[model samples]
Target chain A: MRGCADVRALLGDEAVYEAAAAEAFPEYNKAHLVSLELPDRSGDIIITTYGELDKNNYLDPRTAQVATVNHIKQNCTELRPAADEELPSAYIEEFRSALDVELSKYVGEAYPKGVCAVYCTSGKDIEGPGANFGFAAVISAARRSPQNFCNGSWRSIWTLEFSDESQFVEIKGKIQVGAHYFEEGNVQLDTNIDYKYSTILQSAEDCAVSVTNIIRHHESEYLSSLEESYLNLSDATFKDLRRKLPVTRTLFAWHNTLALSLTRDLAKELAIGK
Target chain B: MEAAMDLVRRMPPGSTETALNALLSLLPDHSIDLLSQVDLPLQVCMDKESLKEYILCEYNRDADSYRSPWSNKYEPPLEDGTVPSEDMRNLEIEANEVFSVYRDQYYEGGISSVYIWEDEDKGFIACFLIKKDGQGKRGYMQIGSWDAIHVIQVGPEEEGAAHYCLNSTVMLSLTTDNKQSGTFNLSGSIRRQMSMTLAVADGHLVNMGKMIEEMEGKLRNSLDQVYFGKTKEMVCTLRPPPEVLNMRLPDR
Candidate 1:
């Protein structure tokens, strides 16, 4: 287990100080929060530091101070017993149900017109001795302009499973947001996050929170930004939206040939009169 | 020019053919010589027949239960294996009567028809059609057609609150021909969908009628804007004005 002092030493005093300064004044901290994974691949730690400089002095190295620290453990082996305890079928069923219950709360709160569904499957592989179990929860919402000129849809899916051959549990999640416009183009954003946790409850809670945060971010930030950019692009190229000739100019003349026939009739009439 | 004249002469005499030939005979030699250089034809008699046939085919297809353009509520060949129920038949008659009045109000002189069918257990679908064909002296002819199809799906009513999904399409086509200026054709369609949840207890028919009325008004405005405003802009881009056409000519 690596402590805060060890992480600080590894990152060096100068880097840690800059990170601390970023935490205090995020605007001034252009580098943002830096996350480093430990060598053992057990977890990741995010550190933010702060520093103040004298406004009047041109050359001054301010003292470094710690602002905030976050430690996320990825490998949670304590969830299972130390012995080679086989996960029972009943336990797996309970876990799946609990995951559904946990994710359903966020689904309802996040999307008014959305739908959420849970799927679970368990079976013994033909070549393996142990049974494999998988659980997935999904939520989707979509809306379109009345004329279908533009439309947008968002979906998030979270899955937890363990294969018969692997002793570790796998947790994966993905969020996809997309919008299509008839005149402009398509905008798509996809994010994927995965971790290895032995316990099902913790993974489910983590997935729910992550999914909710992603949805909130897209609703509040990405969607509006995309709309503004698309509007700007359309305005800048409004003249190009004009309709163009559907056919070649030469091929278009074929339709005019019909009028010449009427002219020929007039010529015949004049000749007969002469 | 000779081939086109032969084609027109071989056509069966109809009102359109007679009008076109009369206009041709009246043209003077100088005008005829100039027009002969361009390779364009006015309206041909066959075009009228084909347009009529196309309209009839569309109407017939709509009438068939198996080939309904809108979503069908009941599966084809009902319990008794009959296509339309008596209720649907009555609704169609009522729609036709109402839409014909609407057509007369908007069009100079035209024919109108309306068809209504059950969508599912929830709601219904209605289609309104209007076609107008006219011809004038000097080989001038115009044809205008409009189709408006509406699909209304009702959601479960809760605490006197009703939800409805309305999907509609409005298609308009206008083709005009002139002896001197050739022909211009404008045709396009727009589709829109709207969902409404209302606390009012208005019947579905009343809601549908109101929606259709509003949609028709909007469609007319959109057509006017696109046809008159956009077409004018596009034409100006394609060809310069009369003043600019002769700008480079020097005094002879």
Candidate 2:
């Protein structure tokens, strides 16, 4: 779908988001856009992914599902893409400026290094020639709000090619955490280390998979739980592509905040990137 | 037919005693000795005093001789010269799980008991710590038979972090079950500290870690309730559940 306008109407002048869906497009609304008003950082963020991506897109869902389970909630926001240089420059600048305010959360000296930015195009139709960030920085940047990809945060372009609506699902990178990183919160570790796809999953792949996996985990109840429980996760097999560190303990609390935020009011409230 | 039904109702793990009677009524081919071998926990047979106790308590001695000795025999010498013989018998058991030797023995002078030995490997992967009554009825008690003493070494999967606690003391207890009802306490010490580096090359150890912690021998109330959807149904696994009977250890 193209040019849907539900989120902006919902925000009602509140700078949290701008959304668009198939209601604006001719066909059914199979696509969505979400942009966030990062009130505390440098620039804003826009996340978008197809509504029908499968769960197999992610490398590992079981060991990694707990990465942000409790923090999830029911979030269904309508996101609108930014018009190109054709649109008003001031409003777009305002959105980007809000993100700069959010960036302050992780701007300290010890902030992670090797950040990368990766995004995908379903139709390969991204028309903007913006300064592209590296994958490491891209992922590092998204850390403040990974769920944006699933909610209303969509960027400026929808790569439409031969009837295919294109989009960048995720941006990639690692935070270079230390040896003493124990995720002992209701939910922690915003992302996962073990990925399963054979294709080198760009950050685009990670975002698509993460969003799709969440939708799938919540779609039906315990139908897939057995498959999740007994799969052959023999080792941290993806460790070769990863760095190693001695972790004392990590408790991934589920049935709590992570799932709540991701499942419920994330897209509507506390809309980080969207 | 009357005799066959009586045999069915006599005891738990007692189908062996009814074998001849059940077979007599059926065609020769209808009854087959599917039994291929007799193994033991350590090849030790029931002690003499316990054998007397079995007969006196109306335990069918005819079936006693046919069961696996190590699993059937219950005797640990309390006297000065008996430990070595017991050790020798146990040593042979470790060699192969196909055969067992049972004997009769008295432990606390007045306490007579049946000693049963199964495969030294998987069947009893976790050493069950059993606590018997200073005075009670006799049999190779299964679930509902006796309280269980949990031990660390009882499960088959003790390797990494678990082996360090010298968790050599896995204690279990017998909950509710389908036989003579009274919990017995079973307990034991690992001959060694244990090794987490156990190389489970292939078959029988895919879930080696889990088997070390819990195996197929014992059953729980949950399995039946979960599997059969009944609150207290005993039809779990078509066999008696492994009850956690003896749980005195504070560590468990």
Candidate 3:
């Protein structure tokens, strides 16, 4: 082991003075007490020797001061994980769940490329002067959150890659929530989007609507005729909507929309008070 | 020069699909009286889709709405690392595409018809082509192995529709107002086979007897479906009722 004076004289860093002082006040060591602040983008100095600077004997009792200090300095970056994983302190998994869960709803209803990514900076119960855990933790929680789409597993997400060579509107704005603090348990995102279907959707919608309309027109007629035939039934008021027969289909199974339409129409006419 | 430049400027880049809209069979059944009056003058852009309201208005079926069935509730989030494949041909469409595939090949008469969406707007080149049937004159569409190939429009409504409690539909009807004077009549199709190969394939088939009956039966049904689909479009133009169309009008 080396003496405090000898160690200091051998390898000098002014920061070691604090280490000496803290050694004198062994019960009240400042080693684990200082505040650490992380930056918004990058460049956060996670390792600090300020406490050592103030105390002369901070690393004296343990002769491994220089080696340990060098090692800690090298490896002491903030514990920001590159991907979702179990670690000392990171909220990336939580954030991803939040974003994904919300995005799932758009599967068939809206295309994925229409969505944009944004940073969330609001959450409650954040601890400490660094505000690092508070904002970033909550942001990670939001990003990793799962978004459920109404259509369920059958429909899937689709993305349109960004390309400047094409005239498509590949670039657009995304809504982001920054460090949000929720007093209550639920995190309420109060954001709205102003979007219109791209030209692609408009064409698809038009064709879909047109085809649907044509099918509806024919099925409606078919069902009405069925109702007239039912006129002969003495007490044919059975609204058993799930009766599957050999289905002597006057129309081919090809015209599914028409069949559904006719059924839906008759349901209303029957309108059995349920 | 200006018009050509305008057309050029209007073209979307690197995309072949464009959305186009044309009126469909929105008229009521009573307008059947006007059938001959107008002489079927309306040239279809694409075979009209059987919409819910149209079915309700014309046939007895209620499709619920004209909007695509695919909504947030029906839509599921795509898996991570999803890569959208190119517009594939012969990717083998799903079972749901039975009718659409039929419409594309048999109805469109050839492979050129399409329903595509490029820039938010979707359009279908309304086309239904069926060759003359086997007897050579009935005009019944030739049913062949390729008939198994049906293209689905891939929208929300087709997958599911609570058919009028199933099997209970006796006969479908239609209704329209007066102030219209004309005779309404539809002739049978002289469906001859489009090719000799199809004719031979169909002739030697085991289900030949049932195939003919089914093909004939489906033709009528598809026509009815297309007609009713048009009716739904018409209702949208006028006023739509949730009960008439099926589901309640969307909020707003």
Candidate 4:
């Protein structure tokens, strides 16, 4: 029966505890202030929520759990507010399934086959702020050609992190398209193209659309360009086989070279006879 | 010619082995390995008549009737006929003659064949084939090309005009082997489709001829540009040319 309001109340209590700890441990507070100024530690400060909270020493496991659930619910619309009995990882799964539903709309229409999955890590493994958690959505599709003995696949991964400090979600995306064609004793062709992107979104409403648009742009622009290049490479390879040398060039002096080598053999034979 | 002459001039007056080594330096490492192992004074000969027969046999294998080089099996004749009409057979013979001349002009010496057939009440289908084989002192090569064109009639689009669909496919295969070097083989096919509407009173053969000619030219250009040209560029990117092997002894 613990609703989102209860989670908010828990977060407020944690904030009060954090303020009390800062006053009690002024030395620890001063060290944190000094560490924040160091440039090398700036990146770690953005991703290591656990390190910051551990130094404060005020967040118990229950408060940490409530803070994570509250942060995710506030940032992502893909999942409902977590229930009291539900784990934080369960919310990640719910978010993943919601995104999967949106992505599956492209399957069989834009792609022949597809698979979407989500992966997450919490506590010490968390690399970014807000609830000490991060998750990645992996979306992939493939188009196959049994006739040509060839297949092509495209994959896009979106790693998302919510930051309480910035009040925004950081989305790092990578897309790759690859194809392979092989026929025994004939030809083998393989080609691939890939790109990476980093985006900051104020809300999760447009996340699914953004991912699909990225896929569409990649397929229409980069993937088609890759296919064109592959066709050219295939053609050139065949042409090289057909004519090793330019037609204008006379044949290599194989006959003359053979004659000279034969004369050398004959001379050696005659010398042995002598 | 100038490059080879320059290479020969750079060779010192030593054993044939030294001269061969010098020559081998200009080639890629794989080719050099093959050439070095070859017995000198190699000789190869290919009989034109036998080659022609072999090509014909290969083309007709597994066929019940007159099989075109581009097709695996002979197409059934339109209407109640066991064989193609005399006019169509005669056209095939004429095509063979024309393609032979083309082979002689471009390929030096090779074999050529053509087949034409009526497609029910629609239009016609024609297939043209050319094959060339060569045997050099240390290597051999075989190259063949097949073009098939199908013209189908769609009802007239307007008064006194007929609409037709022309579909064509061009296939190529090449195999080359050097006795001392490695072997290379490649085969591929490409297709094109077109629609045309011409006056019904116009000679069907003339319209078909023009269509075939244009289609062939466009397809060939596409193959050259999209395939061969792109592939060559990519190959260069994949493996940049190696630096020439320096055969000269460095000055101390």
**Candidates ranked, most accurate by lDDT first:** 4, 1, 2, 3
lDDT of 3 by residue, A93-173 (tens): 243234333432321122211221212223223221223221111000111112210000101111222122342312121
Q: Rate the local accuracy (lDDT) of all candidates.
A: 0.40, 0.23, 0.23, 0.41
Against the true structure, what is each candidate's TM-score? 0.31, 0.18, 0.15, 0.31
Candidate 3 lDDT by residue in tens digits, B1-252: 222222212222111012011001222332343322211111112213432111011111123221111110111222332211233211111211332333333223222121112122231111111121111112221221111111122212222321110010111111111112111111111121211112222111111222333443453343233332232222222223225444543632
* Model 3 misplacement above 4 A: A1-120, A123-274, B1-252
Q: Which 10 consecutive positions of candidate 2 chain A have the poorest summed lDDT? A: A178-187
- When only the first chain is scored, the TM-scores of the models are 0.35, 0.17, 0.15, 0.44
lDDT, candidate 1, A78-109, per-residue tens: 11111212222444535445555555565554
Candidate 3's DockQ is 0.01
All DockQ scores: 0.01, 0.01, 0.01, 0.02
The predicted structure with the larger DockQ, 1 or 4, is 4
Give lDDT: candidate 3, residue A220: 35
Off by over 4 Å in 1: A1-274, B1-93, B119-121, B131-141, B156-161, B198-202, B242-252
